[model samples]
Every structure is written in structure tokens, then in C-alpha cells.
Target: MNATKYIILLLLLPLLFGCSNDGINNNNRYLPNYGFSVDINMELPLYTNLQFTGNPVYIDQAGVGITGIFVMNTGGGYVAYEATCPNQEISECSGMFLQGITAICPCDEAEYNLFNGQSTEKEFPLKQYRVEVVNPSVIRVFN
Candidate 1:
């Protein structure tokens, strides 16, 4: 109510609401631009005869840190995403697992459907990278 009290409240207001356990602004914080590209043939072998059934493969690109390539059994389609948790950005506990049609984050059990990249329960979605199948054996991942 007083002038001194108002000043103290003003200074503490930002600290009160701007802080989070994840240490990032949940509402207004922008996701970092982690644009990168990877050539698949030079990185791993593409099994053409052996059918891939919704299995995720971890790949470490030269420039990009770590990425997960989810190969969907449906028509040989694939979805590639960064191995970083969107909720906390903890690189160590960020890899995802293929659960039916979703990729479950190991950190907080945040499940994201690899089909659309949307979180199954949470509002946030996993950061997805663009994938282009150059040929039957080659693929390119870009952010």
C-alpha cells in the first residue's frame, strides 16, 4: 500500500512469476533454432530387404549433437527428431522411445506421436526435423 512496499513488490513480481523449475519461460520462451542437415547414406546402412517396424535408431551427426530416426513400418515412412527434451532441455535424459505410434521421452515420460510430433498428454510437442528420401537407400534429415 505504501510507496516502499509498492517498489519491493514490483521488483519481486518478475522473479515470482518468471521463474520455473525447468528454468525456462514456459509461456513465452522461444525454441532455439537448431537447424541442421545430415546425409543418411554416409552415416548408416539402410536396410531395404529387412523391413523396419517402428524402431528408432540413434544417430550422431557431425554438426548436430544427437538425433533419433523413427522408422515407421507403415509404408517405410520415417520421422526424425532431436534428442533434446523440450520440457527441460536436458540433453542427457532426452532420447525418445517408440511406443506404438508415439515417441516417449525418457526424462518425464512425455509422449509424442511420431506421426504428427504432438505430445500425447502434454501441450508441448517434440522438435521434429525434416526428412527427405532421396532414393530407396538414401535419406536426408534437415531442421
Candidate 2:
């Protein structure tokens, strides 16, 4: 009788704590894993505008997904974001445009702050890449 009681308690321990699907159900796995490296030479004509603060540029490079990427200078540092709308399903209209310090999605008017990748109207923020300043005039964006 004692052995049976101990066995039942061991089996019931897991049920008492319960289980949650919160972490196991991460939805980001559904999103494609697109990775690329972009080197921005601020001295170049195409990226010269990025040398100044509050300026942004869009680049369509390989591995950047359907919308490419948006890079900006925030006066203090450089930031890069995937130019796709986080709220909408992947489509042609899901591309986002840089408007000052915000990235706007024309499809549904979804806005995301470039400074921190926070979406103003949605729970999921824009996907961001790692930016590294290789030198005074060069910056690298990578996944």
C-alpha cells in the first residue's frame, strides 16, 4: 500500500505544476530565416545621405526577403530593419517605407519606430539586424 501511494504521488507531481504552451508555441519559427550582409560605404553617392543623422535608405539585397532592408542613422548610432510589415502576411504591399524615424507599411498603415523597432499598431515589431561600424565611413549590417 505504501509503495503504491508513493508511485501515485510521483505521477501526479507533473500534473500539479501544470504545463503551458507559451514558450513552446513560439510563432517566429514560421517566419523565414533570411540572412544577409550589407556593407554601407557612407562616402559613396548612393549611401552618402546616410552619413547624416535622421536619414535613411532602402537597399534590395540578396537574403533580405521580399521588402529588402531599411537603414538609418539616429545621430548616436546606426540601425537597420527588415523592410517588411510585421502585421500583415507576406505580400508585395507588405513593404515598408522610411518616413523620418519611423517605418510605415503602406498596406495597412502600420508604423514602426526606427529607433527601437517597436510597432505602433501591432504586437510584433519589425525584424532588425545587427549593425557594426567598421570605421568612420563604413558600416556593416548582418543577421
Candidate 3:
């Protein structure tokens, strides 16, 4: 009886310390959280460049992201990230511009890798969204 009780206590101990927060505890202080969904057709003339790897395209119309979104063809697949710099609050200079495989933030000259969205100068990473390839010609981004 004593052995059974000890085993039950050990099993139930993990339940007592229960998770303090919901599974989704992530809270980014700088970047604004904006829900958006966008789809791009690679066949279109404007987005035709995306068909090639290492090319990134900026989409800024209606509902793409807070300021805009930068979608890139990483050769392996696709990646989409918020255009605003993740290190600081959205300011006039927070909008990032692409230069080769990196997005540069003019405010502090912070650079982020377009392929992985990792920062070269800081620990802040670009806000990324989920990408789904509807077909060979169409890709969707949502968060």
C-alpha cells in the first residue's frame, strides 16, 4: 500500500506544479501584433521575380502586416517576415529594406538574415509568419 501511494504521488507531483501560463506565452514587446493573411501568385508580372531563389519581394497593401511583409525564396522554400525591425518600437526608421540576402534597419543599421530572419547584431529576430504553398504558382502567408 505504501509503495503504491508513493508512485501515485510521484505521478501527481507534475500535475500540481501545473503550467503557470497558457501554452502560448510568447509576448513580444516591441513589434505590434497584427493578424493578417496574404497570398501571392508567382505567375503575376509583379511577383514573377519570386520564382527565383534569393530574391525577396515586399508586399504593402491592405492587410499584409503592420507596416508590410518581406517574402523571400530561400531556394529550399519560402519565408515571410514582418518588414518592421524587431529590436525596437515601430518608428519612421523602423521599416527595413532588403539588400541581398539581408534586411537592413536604418535606425541602428541592424541587419537580419532574409533566409532565417536571425539578427546579425542583436538577439531580436524578425517576426515571421507561416507560409503555405497552395500550388507551384501560389503561396499564402498568415499569422
Candidate 4:
């Protein structure tokens, strides 16, 4: 059409289509379709009749911006929780610790039960990553 009309269209093109590399859908929202995975090797003492305690290992998934993994023995089994705080959405918040079957957040005193991933004092629970026990010495955490 006219040169003036073409110029106007060009100026609005960037706004019409989002400026980010993430693809924009029909609803004018950017969607992130891809994520990352991490495999961590955790060394725990082999269960024996003489040994009653096992060492806890922390795994940091750097690709996903994870600071650390909080691993603790629950007497019956092992429980793992992410170090990030769900309330503040910060990776540097105080980590979680095992209290009975629950994981307590040191930042806001939010306690989450490791048994079912439910909060005891607060309504929101800690964000939990998927953990797969590969063997006696390996565990993989994934989104």
C-alpha cells in the first residue's frame, strides 16, 4: 500500500510480537516450553546391622539455579527438600531441616511435612523436585 502505512506497521511490529525469544502464543503470553534436568550422586552408608546412622548428602542443581538439596534421614527413610524458599521465591533463603517427618523452613518458620509435602504451620508448602533413587549411592533430581 502507501509508504506511510508500511512505516507505521513496521514500528508496531515489535510490540505486536513480544520482544523476547520465548515464543508468544495467540493469547499474547510468552511460554517457556523447555526445562532442565540434573543427576546427583549421593553417598550414604550402606545399611548394616552394626550401623544405625547414614550420612546425608546435598546435591546442587546449578543449571536450574538451585542452590542446594537438603537431605536428611527420617529414621525410616531419607527425605530431600529444595533449599529455595517458596514464600519469598528466593534461592538464598534459610534452608530446610527435618523435624520428625516434617521439613522446617528457617526463613519464615514455615514447616512442611516431608511425608506428604504438606505444610504444617503455613498453607503453602516447599517446592519439591522429583527424586529418583538409582541405587544405594545415587539419586537423581529433576524438575
Q: Rank the candidates by TM-score, best first.
A: 3, 2, 1, 4
lDDT of 1: 0.60
Model 2: weakest 10-residue lDDT segment is 21-30
How much RMSD separates candidate 1 from the native structure?
11.6
> All models: lDDT?
0.60, 0.79, 0.85, 0.51
Better of 1 and 2 by TM-score: 2
Error of 3 at 67 (Å): 1.0
The residue pairs that clash in candidate 3, if any, are: none
lDDT winner between 1 and 4, please give it: 1
lDDT of 2 by residue, 8-97 (tens): 999999998787542222144324557678788999999988898887888887666546888999899888878888766787787788
TM-score of 1: 0.58
- Highest TM-score: which candidate? 3
> Model 4, range 64-103, lDDT digits (tens) per residue?
4255555544456555556555455454555556555555
**Candidates' TM-scores?**
0.58, 0.74, 0.80, 0.48
In candidate 1, which residue ranges exceed 4 Å CA deviation? 1-30, 42-53, 65-76, 97-101
RMSD of each: 11.6, 8.2, 5.6, 11.0
lDDT per residue (tens digit) for residues 48-83 in model 3: 989999999989877778888899999998988888
Query: What would the TM-score be for candidate 3 when compared with the true structure?
Result: 0.80
Tens-digit lDDT string for candidate 1 (36-118): 77766623455342136554555654566344444433355666666556666556666666656667778888877665666
Local distance difference test, candidate 4:
0.51
Q: Which of the two, 1 or 3, has more TM-score?
A: 3
- Which portions of model 2 miss their true places by more than 4 Å? 1-30
